[model samples]
Target: MSVIEEERVRGGVFKDINAEDEDQQPTVIESLCMTCYENGSTRLLLTKIPFFKEIIISSFTCPHCNWTNTEIQSAGRIQEQGVLYTLQVKTKEDMNREVVKSDSASTRIPQLDFEIPAFTQNGSLSTIEGLLDRAVAGLEQDQPIRKATDPVVAEKIEEFIQRLKKLKEVEKEFTLIIDDPSGNSFIENPFAPQKDMALTVAHYKRTPEHNAALGIEVEEEENDEKPGSDLDTMRNEVLVFNTNCPECNAPANTNMKLMILYVVNCEIWRSHRRAGNQNNLTDPSDMSRDLLKSETCSVLIPELEFELGMAALGGKFTTLEGLLKDIKDLIVSKNPFMCGDSSTADRAEKLELFGQKIDKIIAGEMDVHIILDDPAGNSYLQNVYAPDPDPEMKIEKYTRTFEQNEDLGLNDMKTEGYAEK
Candidate 1:
């Protein structure tokens, strides 16, 4: 039988083979070594790992150059969701744990702030220690040349290499993260059947960008009319769509509404139609609401003359207080010049006052108007009184302007007759 055919047949048929039996070893095929241009022996072993899928392990040895190489390939189909493996390596035993790092997996050392990006290395079936050894080897390989040409750069690399070497001592705790969009990477669990306290495994749905990178073409669901029309029909019903949680890249669903508007007032006052509350916007403490501000949405505070545009704070699902705090952080905490010498007294004073006003709004100490103008109509504010109109809050829906539609990329969207294009 041909080597390929025999290999397949061997994989299908299970046999009780003893490790000590030399005669039962799989036959090695003679192959040409690309590097030495000499005949080498190549061995392919098809094996199933315990509690894991089947994998093909291949080894190549070229006697002419004394060159040896090993690699692994998964025989199983790709998983439906991407996986992220976080391992805390605190002890020597942790370094000995086996890891299956696929070519598409990115390895990150959080403490070191170092990352080995995906596709930079080939698939490896190695222990944590072995992985580090291979990395050191790679770094050392280019060092001599670097030392001769760029001594300073080489010196820096040598220092970094030393730091990586010290990690093998297990003197300090460190975290190793393996993120595989292909869902093929794995880090062995020492305590099988029982969960490892130091290890965290998360499965996430691949984003549209990830799908594109993986050469996946996603077809949009067929619709007869504009999506807005469908949403209008189902305005009363809560709409759920697939989305990944920002904090943890886990697969999650975002519940939203298309046209439901909430209008609220603290006092018993009847209101005619108003775009937003402009005067004495008192806190409706009873109306504690959850807010879902989509990335496409904009926040407007006319009192402060502040307009937070799209993509400022990515899609968030939080309490009104939490949302305000995030806004404060974005404007104050995250701004480098807010406190540093780079900021002038006048600028600093303005930001300080602005922050205090936001703080008051968050504390419910001040009465100020806040508006969420969502062009895509995905932003939501909770109505404590659902199934009935909120006496205090006003929810209004308006057609987006040409500029808003263009900004939201809706101008290029062909909701109807898209299949023809």
Candidate 2:
């Protein structure tokens, strides 16, 4: 390519420019300002990122409308992958870690039920506290919040704010989880678990639902390259909530299925007969109504089916490998039922075969789904804004009817052995 030399200086500078080759300045391109539609107000800057990759950071300020906009675009080919970064905020020092969250990153505080879902804001580089503060600002500035008719929701949000403030003020501990499909988001941890760092980072496959929201599905489709499989449009996303067990009223499990219980046998339902005896503060007939309140939710696995029985994996699992390990331990090794199955050894061989298939699923050699039917309504899969949640996350709620309640022994006879009210 021929080099263009511009000599605007005097004779001495002109000779110098003509004598030696000068490094070409980054070509700044001008365009119609996106904000105010003015010519030459917008400037596009090209810069090299780490690894010698080129990228354009565009900035524009409109003098007429006082509008300003800035965006970063990769000039080189972008890598396609997903990432998850988790930080355990133990003290004030841990909260000071720098966080670079892309606009597509989804942030969640699992303990708080707080998630700043994807596509809600622009990319940002901030501290843990700053992210929390940004969430507070976003919640406060939301238009629906100001016009809300439901006092309960508004009150709950206020409570959430207080909890966030307490997270910084007090020495409260919580996990900060961030996920990004474009793989640009990060937490300022050691990025290695064996390094004995307090942080744990896991990278996993991105869901088509996530891609659709970020406009990634369309871009790759136009390129005639398959981004991924065409995800089931019926439900592209599902929220699996971690709730107390409805049967035993125990908080021991999340992402559990009644089907797993049938494997050996479930003890929860039998334990439910004594549920009212534990705490019968309300009228027997009235307290039974709580069993009727139902909500919908589904667990999103995007890549593999989670077939595990973890008493310890907790609520949020950002990757399939971590989840698979916990599950593999439960099925292949443990007598999770707590029952004396050792007295009968006829099923040992069958169990081994079943575990082998499970290993295949985790190894990505095979794909299958396991369904969890939680009757307690403790879990949910909400799609308030998403058009398609995820197909594998099909959730069905079963509420006990009055007849079913009667069969459970909430009959006309009270403790006094008389007709009930």
* TM agreement with the true structure for every prediction: 0.50, 0.38
Off by over 4 Å in 1: 1-24, 50-52, 224-421
The segments of candidate 2 whose C-alpha lies over 4 angstroms from its true place after superposition are 1-77, 143-152, 190-196, 214-421
User: Which candidate wins on TM-score?
Assistant: 1
Best lDDT among the predictions, by candidate number: 1
Error of 1 at 155 (Å): 0.9
lDDT of 2 by residue, 1-421 (tens): 1121121111111121111235423345566766567765656544433321334556676777777765655433333456777777887866666666777789999988888887787766567888888888767665365447777777777777878888886376788899877766656532211132567555454677866765665444432334354333313444355553322222333443222122222345432221111111112122121121122112223234332221123344233344444445544454222123221243445455556755676565665443432223343333222477533334443444554345333333233423344
Report the C-alpha displacement of residue 249, candidate 2, in angstroms. Answer: 54
Worst 10 residues of 2 by lDDT: 274-283
* TM-score between candidate 2 and the true structure: 0.38
Error of 1 at 192 (Å): 2.7
User: What C-alpha lDDT do the candidate models reach, one value each?
Assistant: 0.70, 0.48
lDDT of candidate 1 over 228-298, digit per residue (tens): 77656886888899764442223468898756444343234222221222123477462247788887666
